[model samples]
Target: MDTHTGRRRTDTDAADRPADPAFERRLLAQVERLIAERGSVLAAQGRSLADLGDVEEFAERMVAALPTRHPYDESLGPFYDTAGLVTWLGVSRQAVADRVRRGTLLACRTADGHLLYPSLQFGRDGQVRPGVFEAVGEFTRRGVDGWAVALWLTTASEAFEGHSAVDFLVLHRSSAAAVQRVVEVATADAQSWVA
Candidate 1:
């Protein structure tokens, strides 16, 4: 039962739904590919399969050795390339580059070194949200990578009563104090690891 809505929750609700078999198959395939790639890399480094000890232990170590994927990688996005940003913002490509250089816009760099900006930073008016630049500045100053900052902004947080910073900004545009508080807390937490 959903007390807030005064309605009975149904199994049809997304949260209660079962995983899609096709998605599960894709995930398993990716895991297999990852293990194979890792094994090949190990062989090239002069460590054969025999050196990996037991097969179960080899699988465990290979999985653990895989690099963490960015959280946003799973999302279907309106991610902006440099050309897309130039058109969307009604600005030149150089202007977009300048904003990135100034840390006024957060962009993730691909392994190929191209920048992609998530569309969530833009308001309905197509302008950058007021506190976004400041928040990005704070995170970058504290040495947080762009992907980590993007993940933090999109994730719901109990610290803000379960609203993600981006959602909080959309709902409370007149003030970004909530988002600012989240940024400060993230910066402090990052600093603690170094200390």
Candidate 2:
């Protein structure tokens, strides 16, 4: 038979039901105790469910943590020149020597009249590039080492018609040193050849 609560009577109902009112009260008390001892059962679900509800909270806390843009230091690197350092600096053949005399720029001349300067020390504006303080935090956070970077400035054959180190910037600092040494040797050789 169906009771007013809509529960169906079964053969075991009489046996399963607590005979004493106190026993029924005790069972109810135990259930209430369990509910109190544990947290809301929904809290025990997977992290994904928690994450879905926490998205707005997480965004509120972390929206400012994301960066807005990349700085210019991320784009600068070691660049090279062709047709000698004089031509690269847009100066006459004698201008590099003049700068050397004036103590404005450093230049090591080769025997064949070729001059080499440290291109990395100068920026596109003929002035030293600023240090990376503005973007150093982001650059360091992303683990970028500017030493290994290179920017190749190309020149047409007509501009540098018969140059040796055209269209390539040897980025490796050690490689630049090696090239400078070669220029030193060539300067000595040229001095000897002229003598």
Candidate 3:
């Protein structure tokens, strides 16, 4: 039974439903939430969902546009699988996803469709750095992918004076100025990347 629409869901509802109903439902919900959230801003900017045209083509193009993985990827990980993150943070899997959605944690989907969080993001204290939340939130808000966000945080940036964001963040973890710098540069970088 469907409470929101007062209509029961039936197998015949759509011939195009994917094989995994649960995964499909979760993904659909995420997309709907994003669309609803971004719809107004996109409209004001003279854009519409139709601008994406074909979903498959859009996905392929987005994938193609991502920054290439550099050698830094190996240093960025010791990634935490969902189960390990759940045990480490004492949070449920859904809670983990919620945090990722909120941009307070970094997660990138593996090729097999599982989310993995880098151990480096939490440092040794089991807490996400202050600047990280703001930077990632800005990046994701600008329509950048999570993989790109992770890469941006790890890759060396000449703008940061030959230091990666993670390095600068660690060196000045408690500095408000540094955090603001991260947020500013992150949004700028995200804009250029999307453009």
Q: Give the whole-model CA lDDT for all candidates, comma-separated.
A: 0.64, 0.36, 0.69
Candidate 3, position 10, lDDT: 62
lDDT of 3 by residue, 26-49 (tens): 987986897777777788889987
Model 2: lDDT equals 0.36
Q: TM-score for all predictions?
A: 0.55, 0.23, 0.59
Over the stretch 51-166, how does candidate 2's per-residue lDDT look in tens digits?
A: 44464543332322211111222343222222333333445657655644544443333354533444544544554222211122222233332221111112222322232222
Per-residue lDDT for 131 in model 1?
A: 62
Task: Give residue 89's error in model 1 in angstroms.
Answer: 1.3
Candidate 3: regions farther than 4 A off:
1-75
**Model 1 alpha-carbon miss at residue 6, Å:** 48
- CA RMSD for every model? 18.9, 31.5, 17.7
The residue-by-residue lDDT of candidate 1 on 74-184, one tens digit each, is 652345555445544557778888887777888888776867787777765666676665667667666677787787777888765787777777777637576677667
Task: Name the 10 consecutive residues with the lowest summed lDDT in model 2.
Answer: 148-157
Error of 3 at 194 (Å): 2.3
Which one wins by lDDT: 1 or 2? 1
Q: For model 2, which pairs clash? A: 111-186, 111-187, 111-190
Model 2 error, position 160 (Å) = 38
In the predicted model 3, the residue pairs found to clash are none
